[model samples]
Target: MTILTIPITFDKSHLITIGEKLYSESIELIRELVNNAYDADATSVRVTIAEDEIIVQDNGSGMDEQGLRQYFNIGSTEKRQHNRSPKFNRIRIGEFGIGKFATLAACGRFEVTSRKDNFAATVTFDKEEWEQSNNHWHLPMRLEAPEILKTNGTTVKLNKLYKKFKLDDVERRILEGVPIKAEHFEVYLNNKKISARFLAGQRIPVFEGSEYGIISGELILVSNTNFIVGGPGIEIKVKGVTIKRDLFGMEINFPQLNLLTGEIHADFLPITSDRTGFIKDSPGYHEFNKVMRGVLQRVLHDIKYWQKQKEKKKNRRIVNATVDKVLNALKKNPELASLIGLPVSPEEEKQKTEGEILPKKPRVKRTPAQKRMVSKILGPSAVVARLKIGKKGISCQLDHFGQDSPESYTESNIIYINLDHPLYVREAKNRERLIVNVARLLTQELTLLKNPKNARQAFDTQSKLLKDTLIDTTP
Candidate 1:
């Protein structure tokens, strides 16, 4: 057997490819750089965008010579090993050190200047020059006196930019991608500090613990008229930095979910190499997903409940208006009122107008048993409308009385419309159809009150009443 050594070498183009794939957009490069500062225990990071260059300055624990070497090294494990910042003990945000290479996609050349302890140095990496040097991997470095930097920090300057950076876009990306909410940490774009985006809506808080770690955040059900900054979706963050905005396969499931916007943090979830998504196959990711699913289920339930309440309120308004129209029609046509045993003669009308007081009938109150029976027949969320025609009062209630129950029935002066009736449930999907169904039910019940033994007469009377109430009153 012959033993031979095999060497694995990487081409300069590979760096460009990786950077383009990882960053994708020029704005993403800024996010990676800002996060690097955060991992270095930076309390303040200032990003400046100019016509020809972009600069990122941080007041973090800057790197020494060896630290600079580690910074340039691809896929360095130093941050993963430490896992926390030396001064602040903040959970490190940078896991794959290749984040630095993201600059290659946005600029032709970039320079890093750092000051730490007694050392101060600047390293410049010119993309064109580096690619031309076949096997040479070292970058140009200049030693500067410690006085060059007034404080221990790092400044990265990207020159000969491949793309222009917009101030607004940079500020937004940093606000979403960096851990600005961390204690003592602040990010600025062109001297203006970046703060978390505010959403005005109902906030649903979430906190869950799994074997991996704890997931915590608030989900917002944005107001219908309010414009969401980034549209609908919950931002998923790991280690306080947002990875992506996701709805977790719920965008199409519920129409009300289009108004959802918020963020969730799960520091223990394993992320993909680009840091744009989680590793779905990992145990940590599964646990995080489980927790998020439960949270979203609750959100769905709340949204449905709110929608049902709103619909009920709207329907009640419609029902009241319909009832008023029915009463007005009955008053205009004494013949129809007489069919329901509420005759309003001309003499009685004159007496009423002359202020002749009529004896008031005592109102009847329901006993507990009767109230329970009403609840059972008309559901708890039933909408009730009451009106007086001539000397008689009538009560109309809309509720679910089961599909097997009559479309409508009268109990004393009360008329109940069965929402669960097959015809009613079908017509309820349309506003106009629902109004017609309710008017038809009310006409049937009122006409049948007097002509209980005559089905043909009741049907004719109901048809006339329905036409008068719906056609004459519907505007």
Candidate 2:
């Protein structure tokens, strides 16, 4: 078999602007180098921003003569062919071969020192010279005695800084960009270790069944919708590295703002040459959107359910306040308190239970105002009330009312307003109506306790009179 070698030709000047064309943001340049370190299987990578230059150093298998040649190849796929790191078997992140050259986007010149086995070499790239060298493509290089470190590794120095940036801002960008999740891989910026932000939320699954693969991630519910734009969103991750910060470029009918913030780890997702985002039209990306759409729907459902729970809690709190006031009023009024004793005889218990001796008809009809008060406390349906507050100000599940009736008359001193009533839902919303209704119930109970003979009759009379007179006033 014969192997034929053909030279691939392109404008060498393209190298000068290749980085700029690929990366619009300056922070992307830093990500390119860190990805290279990850591709090298470096356990630890340290990036330093000095007075005049930025240095990125890693401890991993470095390059020899052949390796360096492959590294400089304009669009080499050496990392892709290898597929994984030699030591850790980590998925390589720099397959497009533009990462190293991307440094030119941030600096005018840069130097790389690498060592492997007993061989070590240093190479310097001058962007100005590359652009002016009459199309010459070679960078200055030298073979050297290994002094970089005892172990195999690579160090890249970007000098003649193109732009100045805050160290803190740079660190934050790196934190969001790099794949710091791989095992045995750690990154340090200015000697301080960069830790992945703690994302706390519910986990959602992506691409459950597809030709590509499935990835799992979590959705953190954020309150501030604006933060979702500035902070990271459903990050699109490939090879454990976040390719897209969020669903910024993609077309998504997001259910709500600040509703879905999270990271997805889909290694099969295709990315652009700059590695800043994913290929939007690719089948893999489309599938990701499909899976995430389902996730967001479920997230929206959860949001609705949570809101309902909160509203219930708020209504329960209002019922609790009304109950507390009634109890306090009963405690202060001695006459009402004296009427609160339990029946000692079986006959009295029967009379209270059956209401046989009481009036057969309702002495007073519900006025519209009183009716509205009941609706306010009970809510629209007034079918179920799950929350109860007692005299102790303690919350418990007590069955004070057995039926869906307007009110439950019990000998116990505790007042359990039926929040499920229509009137409580409507009129009890007003403070004056709530107080009047509470007083009406209290007077009814006191009359029942005062005279078992007329207890039922007096209770009915007082309830009707209170409704007609007290609720007649304007809300």
Candidate 3:
């Protein structure tokens, strides 16, 4: 392979945009700066909060003015694959080489101070530079000379913020947005330190059998119960239990983001899990998608997971609001019908749902007899669909009869049985408990029938069917 050389332009115009992204309205700025601090081998990065300003101070090997010019240069290739080294076992988070731009997106003014090899420097830029240049894309305004400190580190101060969101108020939210753990670095909002916590959780069932690759990936604090998958493929581990996983919806960002977030852990990158983990857009991300879909294809998958937590939170509000309306309607009507599944007028639905939800009807208690009857109707062997239970016998149909003392017993499905047809006798090849129960009931009715011959024939046929079912089920 031959080294390819191409002339790349570096001018004042491009420099100003270097840290532009870090100043966005909705974008995450601290995450970008924190990545930079990590790259500099900083084990401790502190976010300092001052009135109307935000500052990020790190104890990493600081940058001299020249180093600052090069490293902070927009689109600088200084972070070539060969020269760069990550200080931790964590995955890579900065890919565009413009993460610092996040500052410009959030604040109207920015400044940096650093010291390296006993040399110190400071650089500051403001909205005036951008406005004065007519947005000509000038290099970031450099004020480096007598650095703020002779110490070995850097401090980034963002001032004149957009104020759409207050730094002092949203520190926790910002901390939550970060993908790393709090133990990695101390985050502060307005001088008050903010502690981080993991997302909520529930029992995540592993694949029934064996896993395909490695388990025990990186840990990410996405949201309570939602951000379990991390590192290579997507794994979750605790003590003796480790789940092997693959493709997360995050792979969808691979094509556009390129390895912006590196494998935060050895278990996560799956160098052994998949060779393509480092290479973007290979089968890795796509494979990740396949795995994600497999885990989330079911409806309740989201009950314990999130494809994109940000989007999920937004959508959850909509669903909750609708449920609240339904509950309110039930409260006003004193009947479930007016609130649930009833085709009342739109005006009625709106009006009836104005009241607050009452305490859930104190859960109607059931007597043992009621429970027994319910067990029979909703038991594992209950015959679903339309069925007539009478002194004559049981006739399978499409409608349920209000029988055996009930509140108009009707259901689209029974508890455990999934028989597609009502009177279909050969339906269950394996001995189904419900089929046997129906046969037994048929036998008892035959014993009491006026005509014994017809009942006897039916019993014989059912007994044979039962025998066949028993054989199949036994095998």
Best by TM-score: 1
Instruction: Sort by TM-score, best first.
Output: 1, 2, 3
Error of 2 at 469 (Å): 20
For model 3, how does the per-residue alpha-carbon lDDT over 80-162 read when each residue is reduced to its tens digit?
A: 45334455444343445666766776788888888776677666777666667763654454455444554577888899887
Could you give candidate 1's per-residue lDDT for residues 1-475 as a string of tens digits? Answer: 9999999978877876787667667678888899899888889999999899889999899999998998889889998999989999999988887998888888899999999979999999888898899888889889999878888899999998878877777877887888878899999888988898677888899889889888999888887725677545888889887888888787787767778888898998888767788889998888777778788888998887776676678669878888877776676667656544444877665454432122222445755434543667555567888756445567888776667777787666678877778998788788888888888888787776654457787787778788788878546
User: Which regions of candidate 1 deviate over 4 angstroms?
Assistant: 1-13, 117-119, 145-151, 165-171, 222-232, 250-259, 324-380, 388-393, 402-407, 420-444, 450-475
Two-way TM-score contest, 1 vs 2, winner: 1
What Cα-based lDDT does every candidate model obtain? Answer: 0.80, 0.66, 0.45
Per lDDT, the best of the predicted structures is 1
Off by over 4 Å in 2: 1-9, 200-207, 223-232, 247-257, 334-475
Ranking under lDDT, best-scoring first?
1, 2, 3
| Candidate 2 lDDT over residue span 240-301, tens digit each | 66676564433255445355677777888888888777788999888877876666667677
